[model samples]
Target: MKNKILVIEDDRAISELLCMNLTIAGYETVAAYDGIEAQRLLLWNEDADLAVVDIMLPGRDGFALMEDFRAKNLPVIYLTAKDDVASKVKGLKLGAEDYMVKPFEMLELLVRIEKILERTGRAKRILTIKNIQADLQSHQILKDGIPVNLKPLEYDLFILLLQNKNIALGREELLKRVWGEEYLGESRTVDVHIGQLRKKLELYDEIKTIPKLGYRLED
Candidate 1:
């Protein structure tokens, strides 16, 4: 099962983007646009493995929300546009696992999440999507009980597609996650690896390209 993450941000665009990206990273997400909605989700709707909270919120604010989250003994990360040293210090002092300023890179966010989960012993290793079994611990994949040998980049690309099943991923997003943000590579790099994945895995129909967009994976 994917880890469940609670996202408390008032901006709908940011919240939705976080949900989409986190889901693509194989984490289930519950988004709350305000503090009251956040409270309701925590109180009666869903349990969360971790929370990403924005310092500014409607109705109650992020710090107040942290009190309730702390009661559950849940891990928290503060994501806000606030870049002041004092705000960062206070949030860390208040027990947040990490603090990220806005306009951050998605790859960094993912790395931080993995690190926090690893520290808390909540990191996931086995991922089963459709007939594909990904054992992260071994960096191997099995399709329908048969091993599928993939080149290093092919395996990385395949995992990203499987995790974001049904969602269209752009070349930029794939590049950042798979090739690292500093890779300065061409979009064709993604295309070549994607082609390799389709041919080797027989996923011609399962993986699709969206016109003017990028690629989407179907179950």
Candidate 2:
């Protein structure tokens, strides 16, 4: 299952950007523009693994929302513009595992979140299936502990296949999901990438070509 992240930020653009990057990183995400909405989301949907909260909110402040997350034992990382020593001290004092001021690098934030999740024993950065070692954090793939270098498109295809293991995914559907539908390319583009993956990573046995369909990566 993918780790789900709850983002509570009032700024529409920032919230959307965070969610987009989180999705690209292979994590499920939900967003609430205000603390009130955040609370509602948390109360009803209790499976959120972590939260990225902004201190300045419309209805409920991020500090107050921490109480709710604490009650549910959810890990949190404060992502706010309040870069003061006092505010940082307060957030850390309130049991936040990590705090990042605004204008933070997305990659650093992801690394910080990964470490917190790892410390809490709530996440595994390395995804394994058969001999495939997919390091989600590093975006690296390995076969039988040996490095497998893949082009960006090839890597994306490989990850998509693993994400839908044992399920048939049509080439068109693969193109839509991995390469985006607006991308001007034929379904044969997927076939070419799959061939490269099978050849380079020795995934020929696992990735089965579906007749009249797309493909399925069997475990």
Candidate 3:
């Protein structure tokens, strides 16, 4: 099956061009004009293997969209005109597997896209957290035989925390690792997700917030 790619660019010219190039490169392409539309498509389309996003857009913008993708463990490449050093650094820091400046060679984009898809396709097996078990492959969370259905981001955040259990993960780290660096939203996003996970896991007091530092899962 051809890998599906979502392209979020408000400019019709750019969007259509990307779609054409992607299709010719043997990838199934879906185009959305803005962040809101892109998000709508993502919720409805479960087959998207990768996302190529532009930094500027109406409504949510690329950074915000990338945050949503990160929570779902989706691999992304930023295709944007925001080519400053800071922008590239931010995108990479936020877990974007790759960043391609706008007006880039189509061949380069194709290569980068393939590389990212290959990397993300690698196995993500079960992750054990204290007494809880998270099977990332099946998106299942279990505690002593009981099942827990976590919101997508909650699941990702829980796994990240569990993987680094007992170690302090600063707010910036969580934001960059889980939310993506281009995410300009409040840092409290991490706290909110953590709170939700703690409540759902019924592991009260398991996640500790260090004053002026960050969060950690107690061993």
RMSD of each predicted structure: 3.9, 10.4, 15.5
Off by over 4 Å in 1: 10-26, 31-40, 43-47, 101-120, 166-189, 210-214
Instruction: Write down the TM-score of every candidate.
Output: 0.71, 0.62, 0.55
| Residue lDDT tens for model 2, 1-219 | 678999999999999999987776667899999989999989876878899999999999999988999998999999999999999999999989889999998856776877787788778567767787998779999888888999999988887776556666788778887898699967898889999998998878889999999898877
Q: Which residue ranges in model 3 land beyond 4 Å of their true spot?
A: 122-219
Question: Of the pair 2 and 3, which is ahead by lDDT?
Answer: 2
lDDT of 1 by residue, 1-219 (tens): 788889999999999999988987778899999998988889863457889999899998888888888888789999999999999999998889999999998767877887798688776777776677888779899889899999998888887777667777889888988999899878889889989888887788988988777898876
lDDT of 3 by residue, 76-136 (tens): 8898899899999988898888898878987567657766765677322565656788886
**In order, what lDDT does every prediction score?**
0.85, 0.86, 0.80
Q: So what's the TM-score on candidate 1?
A: 0.71
| Better by TM-score, candidate 3 or 1 | 1
Per-residue error for 91 in candidate 3, Å, reads 1.1
